[model samples]
Target: MYNFIENKNTDGVVFFTIPSFEKTKLVKHGFSSKIGGVSKGSYESLNLGFKTNDLKENVENNYKKITKALDLSIQNLVFSDQVHKDHIKIVTKKDCGKGIIKESDIKEIDALITNEKNVALTTVFADCVPIFLLDPVKKVIALAHAGWRGTALKIAKKTVEKMIQVYQTNPKDCLAAIGPSIGRCCYEVDEGVIKEFNKEFTNVDEFVFSKGNGKYMLDLWKANQSTLKEIGLLERNITISNICSMCNSEIFFSYRKDEGITGRMAAIIELE
Candidate 1:
């Protein structure tokens, strides 16, 4: 029921989003594609991150492209520091432009939850998963960055818990999307990572696959789905993008595929 279909306009920019999400007039959210923007080389076109070697001017233009396409305000969007932890923060108008437009971003923030309107919550990703949460009933939304470590830390569920605590948002009233990232198809891991998953999840057999030689293929999408379901979100409401960033390197940036030199996409969510 969830598909992150491509959207290419005459301007040469591309983005991906669930059709259902697009239909929700109360919110505007999507994952940007590698196409569009004006960056060159590995950071060519549509690079949204400032930490890379890409020119700041190019990234700034990219942000303008996205915000213009989605009808969002660049200065109102917040960003994440992403330390692979479960840290979730409550956001407000005070955090406007903390990441992109503003020079200072709230450091060490992996996930952000907010009930305020027009304050778009954005999380950066190359191969890391982007989790979007929306409680339409309460008009609350959140965005999270989940790599292997954040997945093991159950950041998705933790974000939900924070919503319930801060906004009284019920999981039943929430719709979630697990955005594109490194899939199990290309995300092979060593014993060090496997041991971490085994310790956090008892049903490792479900998303964890044995590939022999002490190696494993971890399904971060399924891992996050399990985490959300365990927190009481309806199975139907949990939409998985199912797109592997590494596999679709032509359109999305893959840290592994690009050998760590690439652009980052922004998964943005906000109430209109």
Candidate 2:
């Protein structure tokens, strides 16, 4: 089971933990909620998305706070530019602080994986699902952002595949943690997304349930879990935080619930 930790500054944002990960003590990983930081009004505090209307200075301050909270050096953080595509970038020592220092430095990618020590893999999310991967045997870590589009593109499975191909990791030895995001109870989709799911999954109906009328709810967490299972991870090795970003708006930042104008939480993992 994974333990949840709260940030005193950020009211409702939290991170999850895996006991197996603690055994190595070589990897540091946490999922950030919308708490902690110094953005104001709509962003309040802990707004990580630089592109948001939030002031750059405040976002930088927030980044500093996050690095301090995690006991990591802000200069060593590596982030994804998150294009909502399936591109998975393999990080080396040279890629440290690329995205954070300058947006142009970050290659267009949605997921980041690396075996390098002291380089934290960070991804930002508002309503999208954040998936953390760790190879206890190889000591490699990955952070992935999966929205409906990314899920259909198999981003979670791709991250696992990248870990295997790049670091020679064994899926069975990999531990995965799925973080909070929009849940089925509040994630309603249109026919287009439904059609995409149906094309990929034989039992798509099981993951998508009708609430009433023409509205339908999609379980993105379960969808990503299914992808992980298909990629060869043992069901027991995966820990899922079932919190819903939409329903629990008080705790998490939900783009849907907040109407596209909101701060983003971050999920970070590194090899210590």
Give the TM-score of each candidate: 0.97, 0.93
Write model 2 residue lDDT over 2-69, tens digit each, in one string: 23444443433344455566676888777666676688988977888887999999988888887777
Backbone steric clashes in candidate 1, count = 0
Which 10-residue window of candidate 2 scores lowest in summed lDDT? Answer: 1-10
* Candidate 2 TM-score versus the reference: 0.93
Give the count of colliding residue pairs in each prediction. Answer: 0, 3
Give lDDT tens digits, candidate 1, residues 1-272: 33877887678789887665666778988899889989999998899988899999999999999888887888888887888998988889888998676666588889999999988998889999999898888989899999999999899999999999888888998899999899999999989998898888998899989989999999999999999999999999988998999988888888999999999999998888
Model 1 quality (TM-score): 0.97
Off by over 4 Å in 2: 1-3, 7-20
lDDT for 181 in candidate 1 is 91
RMSD in angstroms between candidate 1 and the native structure over all alpha carbons: 1.3
